[model samples]
Target: MSSQYRTGSRGSAKAKVIALVGAGALLLTGCTAEAKRGWLPNVERDTTNHTGAIQDLWVHSWIAVIIIGVMTWGLMLWCVVAYRRRKTDTGYPRQLSYNLPLEIFYTAIPLVLVLVFFSFNNTVEKSINAPVDSEVVVDVRAKQWSWDFNYNYEGQKKYFAGEQAHLNTDGSAGVEETLPTLYLPAGKSVTLELNSRDVIHSFWVPAFLQKLDMIPGKTNYIYLTPQVEGTYAGKCAELCGEYHSEMLFNVEVVNDAEFKAQLAKMEDGHIGEEYDRQPNKVNSVVVEHGHEEGGK
Candidate 1:
């Protein structure tokens, strides 16, 4: 018996050591919390309002998870350990059913929980739906397989054509995925005006926790605020075309000085209107070629 006890203790000690070593290794490798959210990438707390609300929801969700997990495990353990088939109660037992108060207790508790869930959901919705007064208004245009941005600062909307940058078309200029990536200033609310030319598309930024639909012939708006200074990526959440996956944009949150510097260089004009002053060179050449072909 003494020898058996010694062997069991040794095995338990080795197991504990292995567990600790594994935990230490994970921490050293920075593999823990691989699925954790932005708080770690940033040690200081987030100051943005949207992130705060999201954090609150996240905390509440975790609370709900723990509450449910404990209740399930504790109830199961109590039933098995305390209410087992004991020798004292080995004989047949009285059957019982139809406890109204217990039934009400179960039903009412869950109903209250559901009500809480709805309440939190509504709060999140309200936070998202409010009018964003300080946000930068960006007009988005969706074409064959690329995205374009038209920044409307006040009444002057400057179009960032992705014709030369690979971020958008074949090798066109990159679309602002999150818009103003590192170029947008902080503490300002941005209202994105979304539209599509051919098919339906959706813009989504997970970090900002907001999404908007891009419908043809109509425009949609969404509000976003970046609380922290870091790079956040956005993607076309809705399927629009063959190269839907290629549709990407970036949001750059920058300081005030940097933002103003970039904003100063913006210039927007109507290309069609510009042609009215003088016909397009390509169009003029095409017309001349047509006339020559007819004469021949």
Candidate 2:
């Protein structure tokens, strides 16, 4: 009877292992194409030149984490079952004061993992932020609840000063015609110089899979080549004030002809101006008040 019970326990454990493996495989296969690639839904695999590298790093990192999790859980379960107290035992199981090798392994493994992640991230970041002889440069200025885009191409510059978004009754931002739109020529390298007039804001475009902070009195830049021609949504990722949620913009990646025509139209409309223009007074007052109170 004892031998039969032991055999049955082993079989049950094997069955459980098989079932878990089967379930994991099913879930993996059931994932959508995008989810299978990077575990993200509704996101394209590659929207810019740097997006592929970003997605690769993201997916591989998750894979490494999942592998480590499975191994750790398996070891924990083994410890629980293999070292379990038995009915025939008298006293407690032998206890070790320390495990030098195990301790060293746990420490070294995490350090190695961290180093690996950092190395990959640093490589990708350097590639993305590498300076290029860009065909176009955009000076982006962020204010209380709007954006200003100055497009510089060839010998001409075009500007667009965005207005604050319309707020719905529920306090959510509404899509309005007044929102600023930035146009870029597809397949051309462009650099965006980011700055803030009031407080810190983060320029984020989900499709680009990149975001940079706009710091007051400091300039940040991002360089990218738009590979696809389409309209993409952009917003401030940082919470600056009450209207932070209303800070929004649009990016239109069009062909060279369309980009040139848009620039001409902007020039005709006098939509934007030089960076030397005065900052928004309404937001400036708010910032000034905060500074005065802080000084007090």
Q: Residue-pair clashes per candidate, as listed?
A: 21, 1
Candidate 2 Cα errors over 4 Å, as ranges = 1-38, 170-173, 268-296
lDDT of model 1 at position 272: 17
Best by TM-score: 2
Candidates' C-alpha lDDT: 0.62, 0.80
lDDT of 1 by residue, 151-257 (tens): 76656656554431135446565554433332456767777777765567787766676677877667787777656766666667888666676666676677767
The 10-residue segment of model 2 with minimum total lDDT is 287-296
User: Can you write out model 2's per-residue Cα lDDT over 1-296, one digit (the tens) per residue?
Assistant: 69999999999999999999999987887575545644543456667888888888888888889999999999999999998888999987788999999999999999999999899989989999999989999988887778878788997877776767767898766785567888999999999999876678999998899999988778899999998999988999999899888888899999999999888887522222223224453322224213211010
C-alpha lDDT (0 to 100) for residue 231 of candidate 1: 65
Per-model TM-score on C-alpha atoms: 0.65, 0.78
Off by more than 4 A, model 1: 1-47, 87-93, 163-183, 264-267, 270-296
